[model samples]
Target: MLLSFRGAQHLRSWPYFYYRQKSHFDSAILLSNPRNLSQFSRAQPISARAMSTGRGALIVFEGGDRCGKTTQTQLLVQSLQSMGLKAELWRFPDRTTPTGKMIDSYLSSRSEVDDAAIHLLFSANRWEKRAAMLRALREGTTLVVDRYSYSGVAFTASKGIPSLSISWCKAPEEGLPAPDLLLYLELGAEDAAARGGFGSERYETLDMQQAVRRQFESLRDGSWTVVDAARPRDAVHEEVKAHAVEAVRRCAEGLEPLRALWSREPLA
Candidate 1:
């Protein structure tokens, strides 16, 4: 027996008949031996409201420097569009805003910057983009963000700020937005060093980046995947796409906008 879904689980009106032997989520059933669904089954249509909760998945890719975040983000965005889905790509520290310019200067070593100031600035960058990000998700746009609040915390914490624990650093972004899927691209310090020389900027030192990588790892939990950046870009991309697609399927059932960054939860 086999079943194929005719429409969306709750949004589309259809009679799903799961085969006693084999079936798919499509709600259609095929049987090696015939079984009558209409005659001996309860087929009822469910409303769209009851199918799922939450909105599109908020996916963030964060890691140490030069982790192929931009390339992979573009791939995901283009792939999603090829699949006829509405997808948007956003990169943090947008570099278009005044605050972002300051950050760019600090990163380029063109200007002196206070560590604490840069930390908050990074947080502010995300905060500035928060509403747009949320609106995109609410409108059923799958958002692919490269670097987010995680970068703020991880990068800042790596700089030896006494009070800048990950949690402490993230407090300013508590109401920004939470990512449902976070992919932390992992690469060895030596590998990263060999790929390219660090930019002539503050925090671009090898030791600093290694420490930043450590901080990134410390923040890793079930919420993220440590992709081996040492692999070929395509191979890493395949792994990321597979995991991301599964996550998207699981999240699409709800299709409602989420308020994770603003669910009124106190700072962790």
Candidate 2:
């Protein structure tokens, strides 16, 4: 059944239904279909106090370089916070940490490292912050990450590094949090390149971006929501906001514990 954003909000008042984490931020809200709710020994309305014991949603923005992930990530965070939801913005290869510093150097061409090593470093950058990431989610703070393992594995694997296969690149990130909704800012290489051109980062080339796009395509499944990012900024934000609001609704029943990236099944 189609669930509206308001329908999810009303779940709190409707006492008959409750939600449980099916996996990660993906909660199985037993709304409209209450037959299977027998598993939940008790049915409690999902109020703020109830949410405090659970976690928040993990929303990720992924796309090729110059696809406006950073901008959209920030804007979505603002929107969520405006709605009184606890939301924060995070970026991968966070240049602030020690491992991130190395990743920054690698991206800026200031340092040279083996392909496999650098790929691991990028994954490590996320690992170092995994605890805090989990804490934020568990404490009812939604995380709007600018990038994630998808970018790491996609970008590195796009480079055709013989040793750094997709599976190998994903090994380090196996136990990290998985995004409940992966919004892929859909934009073609040429369109993305047209936007202020490419940056000086290592993977800013058109060829690399195309290959990364291919990788992203290969990684997509039901978890992904492709939004056409080639539209005007405001237009894109509208669509993103819609998706973000819906995600908050679906997860409003309270978040699930963070799970490993593609841990339950192999990533296609």
Candidate 3:
């Protein structure tokens, strides 16, 4: 179902946007990326011309493995671009990067790292991309991302590590851009496993996936819209498209400053 514009506005004001004071770690990590430093050094006040053109919204897709996040993100980006909106598709553990290579090795079982260490690496991978992400939104390019911070937190926390509690996992993720809309593709574990190429990934086991799903549930707030992915692909796409279109319209009307991830008091 289409989310009305008023509904979208209400979702935007959800408790997730409540600002939190950045911790020392948050400040240090944000400055670790040289691109971020450069951008800050060159930043200027928004000109009248720039303010006239609104920024793009950050739209994220999150789900357990084999839940069709990749498929849906591509479809949504294509739809938005076809309608002449500036849109791009991005995914995490972006194994192409230097940090991502380490994450890829661990995920592929080619190497081993401590659970906490790997979790930090996943967060670092996203930090590396922060400057570019901010620039794109400010330049009016909507980002349709697959498996963002929610996946990172949910997957690692699912490990049930004593030290890696939900709050611990969320710590490193703070200060990253928050999604304007979070579309979660919900599917049964058995159904997801039945889909092709499920077992190939490291976290595809049924037990692990079940735990991850629970973590996702805990992370859900007003910003999330759950899409039943078991439905036909076209039907699922229509709902995603509707929400995305409304989000884009909301952004164009007057772009809100990008909020930090998990920066606010979550809904009770």
Q: Score every model by TM-score.
A: 0.75, 0.79, 0.79
Off by over 4 Å in 3: 1-52, 264-268
Model 2 TM-score is 0.79
Write down the TM-score for model 1.
Answer: 0.75
**Per-residue lDDT of model 1, residues 132-241, tens digit only:** 77777666667888998878888888877687777788788877767767898888776776665555557667898899888887877775777887777776776676
In terms of lDDT, the poorest run of 10 residues in model 1 is 27-36
Ten residues in sequence with the least summed lDDT for candidate 2: 23-32
Compute the lDDT of residue 33 as modeled in candidate 2: 33
Query: Which pairs, if any, clash in model 1?
Result: 1-30, 2-30, 3-23, 3-28, 4-26, 5-26, 55-256
Question: Candidate 3, which ten residues in sequence have the lowest lDDT sum?
Answer: 24-33
Candidate models: Cα lDDT each: 0.67, 0.74, 0.76
Q: How many residue pairs clash in all the candidates, one count each?
A: 7, 0, 0
Q: Give the C-alpha lDDT of model 1.
A: 0.67
